[model samples]
Target: MMHDIPDSGDQPHLPTTYASVAVIGAGSWGTAVAATFALAGVDTRLWGRDKDVCDGINRDGMNARYLPDVPLPKGLRAFDDMAAALSGVDAVAIVVPSRSIRAVARQVAQHAPAGADIAVLAKGIETETGLLMTQVAEEELEGHVVGCISGPTFASETALGYPTAATVAFPFSYADRLKPEASPAARMAISLSTETFRAYVSDDVVGVEIGGAVKNVIAIACGMMTGAGFAENTRAALITRGVDEMKALAEALGGRRETVTGLSGMGDLTLTCSSTTSRNMSLGLQLGQRIPRAECFDGRPVVVEGEMNARSVTDLARRLGVAMPICEAVRAILHDEADLGQTFAALWARPIEAEPNAMDLSFAHPASDKAIQKLAERIA
Candidate 1:
């Protein structure tokens, strides 16, 4: 069951008033978040490492290189100088690729405004540190309040204002302390609006972070099945088993098991696996079709996060002695160490076990079973 966070007696539809916000990347996701804040009338500045991309957003009000068709709003500003972009901002969103999160966090430490709330939207585990995005923030930005926003969000869709749901996770204590600043407008801007797109806030930062990181790899696995023309049974099995793998990793990392079963875990895996827009899923589809990985991504601008995450996740799982067969199979395929048939065989050959054992079974009890039964009936 999801943990309930009592509304801190703040209006649910108000947007927080901030003097200025800085977005520290100009990739598609970064662009969308920056656009949203800019549309909300926040004095938002976006920093891109590429000079040409920055110039394009500043001059044409569009990021032709990253997001070609979506025109940025008039109020948004773009800059190539990271320090200048971060100066005096009330909040900073780090949207760099997972591989570069540490490096970017270091840069933010050097110049970001003191006491700014650092928000991490990037998803994936750091290979070297075996840390999630929020953990990286804690290590790099010691005093700042850190938060994460993640779910099955598609950047292109979100940029166009297509409704989507995601979880905003921060410490409950920190969120409680920020109650005075939480205006109704802030709540409206971030809250769940429709079934199509929503944002649920949670205090389980560890669970949310793990779900976001691990789902990319699982999505790739599902995409491979789709490309291979697998039947519905296969898809069902893969998704079910994938959740188990994700939960194991989450538990190993000190996250609540229930959080994995929530939006970031099961919800994210299901959405990414089924969606054609997911980069990792697309990459897996290509792999399933016998296309060369190098050729498939030959001219692509955005990196497939799953391809990068698979190795890091696999290494961490092994070090923790956690059974993450799905991620292991993905890593093998990426490294050309296992053929498609062998990978699938490995999955099929695993000894059958009860579903609850796939998760941290300690959370399971008689009452929990009753709750799950009721939830299942409701969905039915």
Candidate 2:
């Protein structure tokens, strides 16, 4: 019963003459996305702010620092010159870390070709404005089509061409008018869709963004449970409770609750929580082991988005008068405001309530037949 914008099979192929794509940020996820586009026959250019990293990718076609042992496609190009990379590209994918999203967007806005549709791959709430990625793009890259791609994708696995699924979110009105002739940039959009990877479209931009941002924090909590030697029952409880926190936050931020239940929400939370490959979850494991955050994060250039998102999400929940005990506890642990034992005790000591209470009922009721019928009508 999930509402999705129909995929227009008419997405234009990359121009044989000179279709260009520039992917900002050459981190693991960025590199993976760039590789995917290149394999799909786009004239792909990957931009890394680090000259050495760019040189490595250009010379060896491998990003050893971030994604070691994975050879990039021959068609993938690397560039350190932001201006050269951005010049004349049909579309650009902004894949920088969450905390640096604004600064990177400004740089792209200044350099990327006019009228380019920016597909943002960065996922995190801006700590300063609490704006979702698309909002940040709208503020910085005015007049450009903004889209978001998010899900429970692991960069390493994605780079290796593992089958993966993700959601692409934009306005439904824009999706309705999507034709091969819409923009020269449309060529880049075609390469974005591929066989091994699938992208479902949605108009619920905020919902998708929230799902991508909030799930990482929940992943951290699940990791804590695992590191603490908790069993499957505990993990299941954490996942369920985590979804509640995510739905509450998503709803308060004007996102559809159903979006959180889809791939971006429940799907992402499950994947991140279950995998040690997740940076946020690994960070939590390290914290649970009593390792200092600085030591655990030492020499790690990649962003553990949940660490930054925890603060912003907690702050937003507080401002909106929403209950997010898990997020609040995470914030305390991250900021050293409380010890893990104290936080764990606080969580355990929380007031007992019915199995389904308050916001919990919102999720439970949706699976009922009556609710499904109502949702079907809404989507139809």
Candidate 3:
């Protein structure tokens, strides 16, 4: 169980931590999260679908396949059976692919303790349902308060115990939305944060989720530009314009655009777009160099979320009457098989418009004010 936090802290920091937590997924991110929690003195158990991965973790003190070099603590447990892994825990975290979130969430709903709050570490819009991972969890996870934690964290660097930061957000209405007994979002943040991994609490759940989903698509566009030998100026333009697109979509979806400028948005965008280590960026690199589509999809170590989210994001944008030209361009190239040159030309040919006005992107909401005030009081 997670202990009560002190009455005050800085960086929205938590003084206490969870006694036990279960992380779902054995991939790089999942492995790193579980190991970090264990290192922080939590009784952490990790669940992966593959028995081999579980056996390897139990025997080697590492997830040799995903995080071969990061040493896991001896106390961290790994299980192939979901129920067995989550049999006892104060909270649950889901880190599988975006596409798998629904199925995994359903499974979690079936087994997680009634008091456990759910956190979504995966980043994507459900292609089939157009629901954010948190929303999907809310839909399937009755009586559970669902929140999101995300930033520019790269798994390898994080698992090796490097300093990392992420934004953990649950709506201000988190308690009212799910159940009366739901723990506050600040507590959820506390349960996952540690000395090295500091988590900042916020009430912008929509803003956080939108940032994660959009940054991956933006990274692919940046990668394509880089692979085609574009200079820094060109890349900067793409990232800047991508932020505009992101801000536009976030506002349309009832999220605060200011949140898009924070860790989840700009921070994540900068890392993914510039790093060749990113799966989405690497895939874009191959495409830019004229690699065949069939070949680009082959042998990737992990799900290149940007490649798949391209279509879903564009589709969502259209349904909501928002303009996300860059994401749409990426969708054309990857999914519609549009000619690269024509797509680029079409993307650059759109009519120039004034940059988004500040008033258009931000609004005051009585409910949001209450949420923000609640968060402020917790960390005061």
Candidate 4:
């Protein structure tokens, strides 16, 4: 059970802390999130599929496999039993690979505490369904508040208590604390935000999801440029055009235009595209250097969400009637095995057109908006 928030004389509805939380993965990001919660004095449980990982974390107070050299809080416990981890947990932060989100959601739906708020840190579109991570969660965790988070922090930096910021967007029902019964998601956000890590709230869940998902593919393209001996101008051009592509898709999918320019969008895009530490970027570097795909990531511990989402994102863009050239190029290179030189040439050879101002929100998608509203109503 979560502690009831005491009514502050000035702000009566804010929760200062959460009682318990479960981070549903043992990956570096998951371990870091669980550590944050535990250090915040919340009872936290980390659930991993591997028994050995759980045993190690419990025994050593560190997830040596994922977050080497980073000390974990004593209050943070690890469990292989999903049910045990969810016991008395108020919120669940899922940090599994994008490909595994649906399977994990199925397990969570069966075992999660009733009314627990759920958020996913995984960034990818479902290959078969083209659904976002939050959408998949909503499918399985019916009637539960489902949210998605995205932003610029690397797991390694975050685990060291370095400054980090993120954006978390939920369905409209959970966007504001209109009613105490409707505040579970808001409470989860408050508990997750700390001095070192900050989480800003939003109602544009679709925008946040799209931003997080597409940025990885863009990062791959940037990495390819870097590995191909391209100058900074080439990388800058890709990043700029990538933002336009993201904006177009996000707006087409009923997300606000401004959302794509915020923390989840531009912030995440910049970080992933520029950082060599990014798994997707590093994978792309290998690809650009002509390394076999299998060999590039053969023994890597992390799953490059960009590699998984490249095709799915391009497919989604086509389905939504949105143009995402950079993302498409990445898919062609990665999935279709197109030659990098040819792809780059083709991209540059495309006809030049006047750029549309992404700031303008006049383009309407009533059907998309209505569908999202209906979903929110049904779940609410």
- Model 3: per-residue Cα lDDT over 71-163, one tens digit each: 888998999999998997888989999988888999999999997878899898988888888999998898987999899899998887788
Q: RMSD for all candidates, in order, please.
A: 7.8, 8.6, 10.7, 9.8
In model 3, which regions exceed 4 Å deviation?
1-16, 174-183, 297-302, 357-380
TM-score of each model, paired residue for residue? 0.84, 0.85, 0.87, 0.88
List the lowest-lDDT window of 10 residues for candidate 2.
179-188
**TM-score for candidate 2:** 0.85
Residue runs of model 1 more than 4 Å from their true location after superposition: 1-15, 174-198, 298-302, 358-380
Global local distance difference test of model 1: 0.78
- The number of clashing residue pairs in model 4 is 0
For model 1, residues 278-357, the per-residue Cα lDDT tens digits are 88889988887777776786656658889889998898899999988888888888875677655665555555456567
Quantify all predictions' global Cα lDDT against the true fold: 0.78, 0.78, 0.81, 0.82
Please state the error at residue 338 of candidate 2 in Å.
1.2
Best by lDDT: 4
